[model samples]
Each structure stands twice: as structure tokens, then as C-alpha cells.
Target: MSAPAAALDWAQGVWDWAAANWYYPDEPGRGIRPRLIEHIRLSYASIAIGLLLAVPLGLACVRWKPLYPPLLTGVNVLYAVPSIALFFLLLPYTGFSDWTAIVPLAVYTLVILLPNVVDGLHQVPDHVRQAAVAMGFGPLRRLVRVETPVALPVIIAGLRVASVATISMVSVASLVGLGGLGRLILSDGFRRQFDAPIVVGVVLVVLLAFATDALLVLAQRLLTPWARRDRPRTGSVRRRRAAATAAADAPALASTAVAPPGKG
Candidate 1:
């Protein structure tokens, strides 16, 4: 068959399979729709747990310079572990439950989130921080008010990457007998050598990843409007804003930095 012909056939096949299997009133829990919901839940849980873990660890690392190396190394080691192996290791304890999938996926996010959070905080120019400190902003207050807003773009970038990775990783959960779109690819497709389910599974995963990433981007724009240009452009807005903020604060920060000790 020609490429166009094959493509058309595959498209038709997908539509047909979705109609039959995407949702079935008779078999409520056993359809593509449920699997997709499972996939989304798994992805969201993973990213949430990862943020809860990583953000604090990342903050601790930035607050205390000594903690960064060891914490980063540990998460990187977790990242290095094969997802399948981790799932298997968790199987005995977590069983064929969502936790089995969520634990590993959440751990994987730290490899991205940890560094990004720390780096984003560290990326704040020394001068701006000095101005903040001089302005009577305490450590916690400064971090919340000043550093966090400045750091949001980088943190959100990491979030976007982590969200997509988590979504992709959720498919692997099917191996542990948990349901997700992966069941379509693994049990429903590969086991039966059917193309439709596999194609549907793959396409859904991609679309979910894309949708999740787009939401994170919109979040970044909202969270840090200072980083947005008069017109939107990729890769330049945050850098320009960070630089401009630093440069604009340079004169003020300079006096704070060079002030004699114990001088009021």
C-alpha cells in the first residue's frame, strides 16, 4: 500500500477502535476513557509529590550550600535507575496499585526539579539579593517575595519538562498490572498484535504531554509577568528581565554591598 493509503487506513482504524473501546456503557471501567483518566491521575500525582519533595530539598540546598551536592547526587541516582526495575522493586510493597507507578515517576521528577529550583534561586543576581536584604527583607520573606518570582520561569521550565516526562513514564505502569493508556499499547495492542490500540495509546500520550507542557507555559507567564516581553518570544524574556533587574538595581545594590560594617 502507498504511504497515503496506509495513513488513511490507520486513521480510519483508530476512529473505529475509539468508537468501540474508548467508552462502553456496558463495561464502565474497562475502556480507553478510564485508562486515559488513570494515566492523567498518575501523571498529576507524580508531579505533585515531586514538587512537594523537590522544592523543599532544593530550597534547603540553596539555603545551605553544603546540602546541594549530596541531595542532587541522590536524586540523580534515582533518575539513573531503570523505571521498570523501580516498578518491580516497588511491586512487592506497593502491589499493583497506583502508588507503584506514582512513586517511581515522582522520584524521576526530582532529577529535573531539584536542580532547576536550586539554580533558579541561585540565578538571582547577588546585587538584587543585596538590595532585598538591605531593604529589611528577611531570608524567608525575600525568597517568597523577590527570589521566587525571579526564579519562577526557570522553575516552570523544569516543571514543563518534568510533567511531560511523568506523563510518558505513566505508560510504563501498565507493566505492573495498573491501568493507563499503556494497556492499550501493551495488553490490547502488542499482545494481540493490533495496530489500532497501540496507535491510539501513542497518540494520546503525546497529546497529553503537549497539553500538560502548554499549561505549564501559561502558568509561567502568569506567575512571572515581569519576565514577559512587550511581545512574546521564546528563551529571551527571562534572561533579559533577570539582567535588566540586576542592572537596574546595580547602583542601589552597590552601596548596600560596600557599606562599612556596623554602620547604620
Candidate 2:
């Protein structure tokens, strides 16, 4: 059979199992939707909190050079720490509650996002800053109107990376009873029902990542239409003509000023 037919056959089997086993009272914990939603909510919450803290912190790091080294070093160290290790480390203090998952997940986002934010801010040209200043825009005003808008694409790229990282980490969070697709994997894996949980986990992750990427693409088009649309083909043509005119005039002016090579 074809790939689609094989997928359909596998899906039909899983669906039948789910239909018979889900919420059967004897199976008490079979419904996957609630667990999936809880996982999603936790991941979203962590990422939101991470962005809230990291964006401003990132801005500050760029604004104040002294903070970048130490601050980023800390974030990097945290990122390097293994996820399972962090989970176990937190378990004693936070005891496997949502906090255990959320705190580490939020911290992980900073490692992925902060450098991108700083790079984005730094990518704003000096001429733009000077122009904004000449227009009487103060520091905060310039940052809000000029710098932030110009840096938004890069910033959003960082956010996209951070979001994917958050989702992946939250899958690890399921090991601590947080009830994500990871929980399904762990539960079914233990029962030697290998295919179902692996299939669900892989499908969930692929779908989630694709959905996020699509949303980011939509956001980029909406927020930065100039970035997506073909500008060089249209605008560059006019610019090139102007440059060619300037170049063509330069030799004529130089030749006219040569004093005919004998009038001196």
C-alpha cells in the first residue's frame, strides 16, 4: 500500500483503541486531550513569562555593555545544564509541581532568545539612530519607533526559536507527571505498546512545530510586508538607474574641467 494508506491504517487502529479505552472508568486515565491541553498551557505560560523577562533584559544588556558578559554567561550555563538534571535538581525543592517544569523551561528560553535580541538591536544602523536623534526623538522614543520596528523581524525570529525550544522541553516535563504527550510515551512505552505512543508524540510535535512556523510566517508578512515582498526587483531597478545616471555624469564633468589639455 501507499504511505497515506499505511498512515490511515495505523491511525484507524489508534483511533479504535482510543475510542474503546478513553475515559472508560476502568481505564480512568486514558483521555489524552486534557493532558495535551495542560502541557500546551504550561508551555505557553512559560514562554510568555520568559519573553516578558528576556526582551527587556536583552534590551538592557545591549544598552549596558557591562551586564552582557555575566548575564549571558549565567543563561548559557543554565542552558548547558542537562534538562533531566535540572528537572531532578528542582524536584527536591519544588517537588515536581508545575513550577518545577515552568521555571527551568522559562530559563531555557533566555539562552535561546537573548543573544538574538541583542544582535537585532545592534543591527540597527548608526545613520538611523542619528536621523532619529536629529528629528528630536529621545532615547525611549527612538527605541520604540525606530529601533524596535527595525529589529522586530530578528526579535520575532528569536521568539520563534524560543517557542520551539519551550515545546520540546515541556515534553521532557511530562516525565515529572505534568501530563503531556511525553506522558503518553512514557506510559505506553512501559507497557510495551511501542507504536501508539511514539506515533502520537511524533505527530503532536510535528504538527505543533508546523503550526508555530506558519503563524510566524503570517506574522512576518503582516508586520514587515517589506521584508517578504520582492523589493529589489522593483525598487532596485529605479535605484540602479539613478546610480547609472550619476556614474555617467561623473566622466563628463571631469573631462570638461581638463582645460582642453593646452589652455593652461
Candidate 3:
């Protein structure tokens, strides 16, 4: 057979394997579906926990600006450590369990999220804070009603990035026995020399990341409807700038048009 025909046969075989092994209720938690679910749980749980921790920490940093730099340096140190090392370090305390995976992932999420959260709060204009204060809005109320609203776009953007990163990182958890889809790639696929599971696992991981990001974007739209509206279109902004430039130079042009040309 030709190379193309051989390749086609291999692909068909992989597809057959996928169809046969996609779900295995008889095994009670060993198949692709179960692994995928575990992956989702790991990814979302870490992100949720990180968001909870990072928000308050971010607020505290904002309230006390000096804390921001040191806090960031610390998280950066955590971020710099290898994921596997983090897992091994926690293995004693959170040994052989999901918490081992989750604890480190959450910390990683916090590392990514903290800066964005701080920056998001900083994005809130000083004038807006002054207005809120003028209206007798308390600190908490101003944060919830005004500051948070302004910050949502940035926070949500960070969430999008962190969610994707966490999803990809979950594959690493398979090293400690919670690989999710990664088990298919690193365990059976590598051990058995099967190509299908590896391909399917990679494709599924990508799909999950895309799906999570899309959901976050939808949530962002729902939560910050004004963000989209407030964003200026590139063309419109260019037009406005061009018009302003013309207006600014209008008097100069007018004077030039009226004045006699200077001899060179």
C-alpha cells in the first residue's frame, strides 16, 4: 500500500480505539470520560480557590501599597519553583491525594492572579473613587459598586489566562497519579505504544481549555456589559484623532492659505 493509504489505516484504527474506549462505566472511573471529568474538576477548583484567595489579598495590597511589591516577590518565588517539586514538597502533608495537586495549582493560580487583581483595582480612576466618596459610599460599597465594576474587565481577562494555564498544567498532575487526560498520554499510551490515546488526550485537553475560556468570556460579557461598549473601535478612534489633528491645524492652514508665499 502507498504511504497515504497506510496513514489512513492508522488513523482509522485510532478512531476505532477512541470509539471503543471513550467511556467505561464497568470500570467505575478509569475511562476517558472519567479522566476528562477529573481534569475539569482539578482545573476549575484550583482557579476558584485562587480567585477567592487572590481577591482579598489584592484588596489588602491595594489598601497598603507597600505590601504589593513584597507580596509579588514572594508569589514569584512560588511561581519559579517547579510544579513537580511543589507536588513532592506537599506530598507529605497532602500525600497521594487531589489536594496535593490542588494546593500547588491554586498557589500557581494565585501567582498569576495577584498582579492582575492589583492592576485591575488600580485601573479604577481616582476621580471615580472621589465621586464615590462624595456620595458617601463606604469603602466596601465603593469597591463592590464602583471599583469592582471597573476592574471586572481586567480581572476577567486574568481569569481567562489563568484558566487556560491551569488546564494545561493539570496534565502535569498525571505525574503524581491525577493526570486526568494526561493519564492516557503518559500511562497507557506511552506504555502500550498506542497512538490514539495520546492524540485524543491532547485534542481533548485543548478542547477543554477552549471551552473554559469561552465560558469565562461569556461570564465577563454578562458581568461587565459596559466594558464592550466603552471600548473604542480602532477605526472610530483613528477617525477622531484625524479630525482633532485637522481641527488643531486648521488655523495654521488658514493663515498659510491667506499669506503670500515666501521667496526661497
Candidate 4:
């Protein structure tokens, strides 16, 4: 049979099996929807927890420049560890629990997120920060009100990347039999039901990544209007104001020039 025909045959078989054996109320493992939801939740939870840990850690790292290289190196080393190897390493202690999935995923996020967060904070113009400091804003106030707001778009960009990475990595969670769309792919592929699993997995991943990126774009638009707005367009406004001020001074200058020296 052609590849398409073979795929259709496999899909038909899987669907038939799914129709008959799909509803496992007690186990809740048969439907793709529930498993996909588990995957998404795991991904989001890991990213959220990682962000909580990483943002402050990144901020702290900024204050301690000497520590950044070593700390980032450690996170990078941990992130580079193979997922299967990491899973096995954690198996002894976590033993296939949700914590096992969460911890590795969270650790992976540190590598991707921390550097970006630190870079984003550093990217804030020095003068902007100096101006805040000159205005007598304390370190905390400057960070909270000026630096962070300016850095938010970049920070959120890092978060968006981390979130997508977390979602992709969560597929590994199914190797430990933690339920996910990966479970569907694994089981169906083994059964030679290629099309169904591939379709479902790809669709889920694309949709999730797209939705997340769209949300981040919306957030950037909302938070960083200045990034978009403070452009050459504002130079036009500045030029117009300058012209108006010069015009207001014009008659006075003309009158003084025509009014005959310092006699008045």
C-alpha cells in the first residue's frame, strides 16, 4: 500500500479501537483530551514555579556579578543533561511522581530563563536608571517602578520562550507513565497506528505554542507601548513644540531690535 493508504488504514484501526476502548472513567487514561490537559497543566505549572524561582535569582545574580558565570554554568550543565538520564536520576527519589516531572522541567527553565531575564534587566538604558536614582528613588523603588516596567517586554519574551520549551519537554514526562499526549503517541505508534498519534501530537503542540506566543505578543503591546510609541514620531512632536516656542519669542525679538538700542 502507498504511505497515505497505509496511514489511513492505521488511523481507521486506531479509531475503531478508540471508539470501543476509549472511555475509561475510573482510570481517565483513554481519552486524548484529559491526557493533553495533564500535559498542559504540567508544563504551565513547571514554567510558573520556575519563573518564581528564576526572576528573583536573576535579580540577585545581577547584584553579584562575580557569581553569575558559575551559577549560569551550573544551570546550563543541568539543562544539558539528557531528559532520559535526568528522569532516571530522579526516579530513585521521586519515583515517577508528579514531582519528578515538575522538578526536571523547572530546572530546565532556569537555563533558558535566567540569562534572558538578566540580559533584559541590563538592557534598560543606564541614563533611565540614573535619572530614577537622581530623582531620589531608592533601589527597590527604581527596580519596581522604572527598571522592571521598562524591562517587562524582554522579560516576558524570555518567559514565552521558556514556556514553549517547557511544553515540549513535558512530553518526556510520559516516559515515566505520567499521563500526557506523549502517552498517546507512544502507545499508538507502537501499535502501528501512526497517523492518529502524529496528528494529535502535532496539532496540540502547534496550538499550544501559537496560543502562548500570541498572549505574549498581546502582553508586550500592553506593557511596552513606549517601546512601540517612543520613535521618530515623537521627534515630530518635539520639533512642533520647539517651533511654537520660537514663534512666541519672535515678536519680542523683532520689537526689541526695532525699539532703538538701550534708551528705554
TM-score of each prediction? 0.85, 0.78, 0.84, 0.77
In the order shown, the candidates' Cα RMSDs to the true structure are 10.8, 15.2, 13.5, 17.1
Give the better candidate number (2 or 4) by TM-score: 2
On residues 1-264, what C-alpha lDDT tens digit does candidate 4 reach at each position? 899998889778756755654457877756777777888888888888898888888888877888789999998888767876777788899897887888888887777788877887899999998999999999888877888788776677677767767777777677788736667766665457565665666567668867875676666666776655333545688785565445433433443344222110
- Among residues 3 or more apart in sequence or in different chains, the pairs in candidate 4 whose N, CA or C atoms overlap within 3 Å are none
CA lDDT of 197 in candidate 3?
Answer: 94
lDDT of 3 by residue, 1-264 (tens): 999999999989888888888887779686788999999989899999999999999988988899999999998888888888888888889878889888988988898789888999998999989999999999888887888779877777777777777888888888888859988988978889988999899999999988986687568657766654333655687675566445433433443354222200
What tens digits encode model 2's per-residue C-alpha lDDT throughout 113-207? 78877888899999988999999998888877888788877777777767766776677776777737677667665458667766666577657
Name the lDDT value of residue 36 in candidate 1.
93
For model 2, what is the alpha-carbon lDDT of residue 2? 100
Q: Which residue window of length 10 is worst by lDDT in model 2?
A: 255-264
Q: Arrange candidates by lDDT, highest first: which order? A: 3, 1, 4, 2
What is the alpha-carbon lDDT for the whole of candidate 1?
A: 0.80
Q: Which RMSD does model 3 reach against the true structure?
A: 13.5
Tell me the spans in candidate 3 whose CA falls farther than 4 Å from its real position. Answer: 2-4, 230-264
Clashes of 2: 0
Q: Arrange candidates by TM-score, descending.
A: 1, 3, 2, 4
Model 3 TM-score on a 0 to 1 scale: 0.84
TM-score, cand. 1 vs. native: 0.85
Higher-lDDT candidate of 2 and 3: 3
Residue 263, candidate 4: C-alpha displacement in angstroms:
85
